[model samples]
Target: MANDFPFFKKQSNNWVYTLLLLPLWLVLYLNLQIIADFLIDDLLQLQNGNHLTEALRFFIFETPKVLLLLILIIFLVGIIRSYFTPEKTRKILGNKSLFTGNILASLLGIVTPFCSCSAIPLFLGFVEAGIPLGVTFSFLIAAPMINEVALVLLIGLFGWKVAIIYIGTGLLIAIFAGWILGKLKLERYVADWVYKVQIGQSEEEEKLKFSERIGGGYAAVKEIVGKIWIYILIGIAVGAGAHGYVPEDYLGTLLGRGNWYGVPLAILIGIPMYSNAAGIIPIVSVLIEKGVSLGTALAFMMSVIALSLPEVIILKKVLKWPLIAFFIGIVTSGILVVGFLFNVIM
Candidate 1:
């Protein structure tokens, strides 16, 4: 059906249609809040300060907003990833010093935003391309944990300070933890299937024409957004529930900064609850407003997005239990340290 649409097909004239349609997407995205407000305030006849009304408004407003952001980010990221194929990544990082490769790979994670499930192919590709385990780990960690959407949302919802802190710590965690894993030389633990698989070489890299990149972007929106939209809806639903009825004082008592156990407890709780950063930010905001400590809240948020149980289960396809356990331990410890340090200093 998509191929039957002239603009959707890969064509020389695709950029023209892409440019023409972007404004329409933007206009609709910008008006979502108004629509949410109308439904909550006028149609539902809900009071402004009421928690139930606020939660419903948030759910209504954020669901579409997050989906739109995911589409836009995924499309752009797909175009970028088109340039950085597994072969290309291997060629570039394959020969570099391990430390340097880990750093570069972690930085690339910001732009190449593959989620947990989507990351497995890249992980396998990296291994097949002869990319080092440590470097592969860096990319894997960074891709989902510190992607552009998460960073942008953090900055928008919190201040630049919070966003910067998250980015810096996330990078550090990916790099050093990958470095540690690299030093451990745990190659024997990787699933045999990953080592056995091979990918064919691709054609030479030429600059894709503008239209081709646009088509690639369109394909990305379809593929990536289609897979994760349901997760986004579910995450937002969970966030809305927390926003609407969770007692603020109870949250503060449990996860507040002064509580020494808050960080680890938050981490433990967050691991079981899966969410993307977009879906979790609304709940984070409410948690902070309710007096949960910033560090603890951040630890909870990161654990939910980056180290969720679902991601661990998905990774089990390639990583054996020991390596997976190690990866989790190192990351969890790093997050705990970050949480404690931030709570003390900030």
Candidate 2:
């Protein structure tokens, strides 16, 4: 009797699967946008009034909505990711042509939602698996730079155009930087201890069942949401304030559209900060609206994603100084190129 359902039938191809999923994805996207819009607009309306009650009301309503949306999305992505066993990923990467592996790793990185803080463990795992340093760097660069959180937030606030550019440029940077580093033969810079890890066993052997995946997703939501709630609130509040209050002329003068140094300054400023991709995205949107060059703002964002001081510190455990510095230099140049191209084109 269940076979009568045409939609459930597997044909010669899975095109129908995508056709079915696309509508579901669209619905989710729309629902998310509606919630974001309602929260932001209502808060703005209340702020127009000059009363403590209204101010408190605004805070009470908007903050929770933003946080809820973020957590829900993270859990959903985690659930999707749980289906992707790392052993399957390793098989794909095992072919290991430098160019192909770099591209594949960078693309894989975008969908894997680990932040810079979690990157060290993942990096160690990749090294122990005998993945090349450059390919691993591609994963490292792409992970934080093209996070699902940032992509969703961008689509919610700025629409798909900005989001596409952000995602595309990030992958390009990761790919090129990884390839360049591979060509440079920078493997010798790995901490000597990394070479000694036994490779027969991999973390991917711990497979979660469907029930476990759901449970893991819930745990991921709780852990990630709990930790970043304050940061998200503060970051969004600062972005909102800037949105309402910052003078465009002031921003223009500081990060003028055509200024060559603007991109470099953005990267430099972002390097010392310890924000994740999600935290910095709202700020990037605000900066763009306030007349900062697209290149400059994006470069800043990429730097925060790839070169945060804390991330570097964590990498120190696995990499010698020279290797770390080389990684930084290569990725920074990639970001600069991306920044310049977008500024010129868009």
How would you encode candidate 2's per-residue C-alpha lDDT over 101-196 as one tens digit per residue? 999998878655565666766777777777887888888888777876776666655668987998988899899999998888988888888778
lDDT per model, in order? 0.80, 0.72
User: Which stretches of model 1 miss by more than 4 angstroms?
Assistant: 1-6, 21-72, 113-115, 118-121, 159-161, 191-207, 222-247, 278-286, 310-321
Clashing pairs in 2: none
Error of 1 at 109 (Å): 2.6
Model 1: number of backbone collisions = 0
Location of the lowest summed lDDT over 10 successive residues in candidate 1:
1-10
Tell me the tens digit of each residue's lDDT in model 1 across 224-269. Answer: 5676566567656666766645455987988887899999998999
What TM-score does model 1 achieve against the real structure? 0.75
RMSD of each: 4.4, 7.7
Candidate 2 TM-score, C-alpha based: 0.75
